[model samples]
Target: MPAFQSTFDALIQSWKLRLQDAEAHETKLPARMETCIRVCEESLLELRQWVMEHSFPCRECEIYFFKQVKPVIKARYIYYQKIHRLHTGYFNGSGLLEKERLEKELRELAQYFTDNDQFFSYYRNGYTHHDELFFVRGQYDWKICPEVNHFDDLFSTSFDGKLAELMAYELLMKYVDGMLNPSCKLTEPATVTPSRSVAVSRLQCTASVTDIVELGYALHAKGFFNDGKASIRDVMTFLSTMLQKDLHYYSRLFFQIQERKSNVTKYLDELKAGLTRYIDQLDEQDQLK
Candidate 1:
């Protein structure tokens, strides 16, 4: 699981870096959007191929992948596609006309939410009573399932795509609101204390981010921090700042770790072996002395 997750995280990170670079260098909005759309399509294709080749270890892992992991990636694809369509029709000179169009689209999005209020509430509230039917493969309930043009029983669930759609709509709403009121967009505050800066500079992680993420999760699972009072998010944030690596998608990566076929604690096992070997070396030195 760690191997596959590390590969997947690397793939996502590479594309995200490319997208960031494109945004920085490309002045044209359409060209940048094209790059984003192409990258998303490529990612989805690779994910589909992986799904086709691998069998999940169990139903729960499958549910987590489809419900939590896959939707995130799919939501990005849907967002870019929708944004591309919206921008292609954007009116540059007529502010009033564009505002009207955006408002109409907003209303439509609201209507979609109203239509799926029950499922949206279920998702928003973190209810998992219907996970088996909504996320598991081939558990589609026709009476409740949304209309999908193309359904792949092997790779898709009844509600995963809809879940992606809901997430995409959220992004769209924020974007459209930004367009409507540019000042409403929030910006991250740039402030760093000198003491904190010194602390971060002194600490460094030589291992890969995936390795660090694995270690962070293990620590969290074992209640190593603050006697289990610390949340995973808190732990990952502390590690990220200390190690100078972004662990934004640690949960998705951890999901992949959970789905490992064998040796699920690969990193933890390696850590134990390395510590034991170091102790053995110390004993040999003592014998030499």
Candidate 2:
């Protein structure tokens, strides 16, 4: 009876230790984490404008889905990957790991990435293939809430799609900032582009989906379903107003748009530069005010 009691006590202690480790492993999200969150919020701001403009019974879903969603999703993946690597490194570095450790590593990785596929892959499908998962139902005053099984709720603590996207933003801030804690400022980030001229050149060369989608949505929202304007500059200007709304999203989406171009690196550089400049201007205005 004494031996059994001791074994039970050890098992409880082990379980408690594992739980503590899992919770402790998260660390307190870092400063760059906030940067990531800001980007996510900006994306949603653009998204909300697009949604409010388009609303329902309209054709175009969004302008930048293929262009932007992947990058935003991938940024989250990078954060999760960092966490996975951190946990794995901690276990390996601890030197007490054993043959039984494979299960623990596998379980921890699963918790972060889930089944060896990157978390972004799930988001890529979720954001773009939303129709495959949700539909408008009911007989009257029908709503556009996600289906009961849409994986989006996994990203949500607030249950609003906008809020879920925002959660991803906060998660990003916490994740990256966790890496940059104990140091207050992470003032410099690697820009997607280095020159303003390059950005404007590309901005002239290719059209942003934001412009087109906003035009479409504005038409939908205003009951003006056929005001056809294919001007990229117009979209860019609309995107500008949105940038005025969210700098982080504007910059990320700008990169995503560039990613879609044939000369992706060049375009990305320009777009990156353009957003960096745009955000700087806004930051300056805020400082002055």
lDDT of each: 0.76, 0.39
Across residues 29-60, which tens digit of lDDT does each residue of candidate 2 receive? 44334444444445445544544454333222
Model 1 misplacement above 4 A: 1-7, 92-97, 184-289
Query: How many clashes in each candidate?
Result: 0, 14
Among the numbered candidates, top TM-score falls to: 1
lDDT of 1 by residue, 41-89 (tens): 7877888888889888777778878887778878887888888788887
Model 1 / residue 67 / CA error / Å: 1.3
**lDDT for 147 (candidate 1):** 86
- For all predictions, the C-alpha RMSD in Å is 17.2, 21.8
Clashing residue pairs in candidate 1 (N, C-alpha, C atoms within 3 angstroms): none
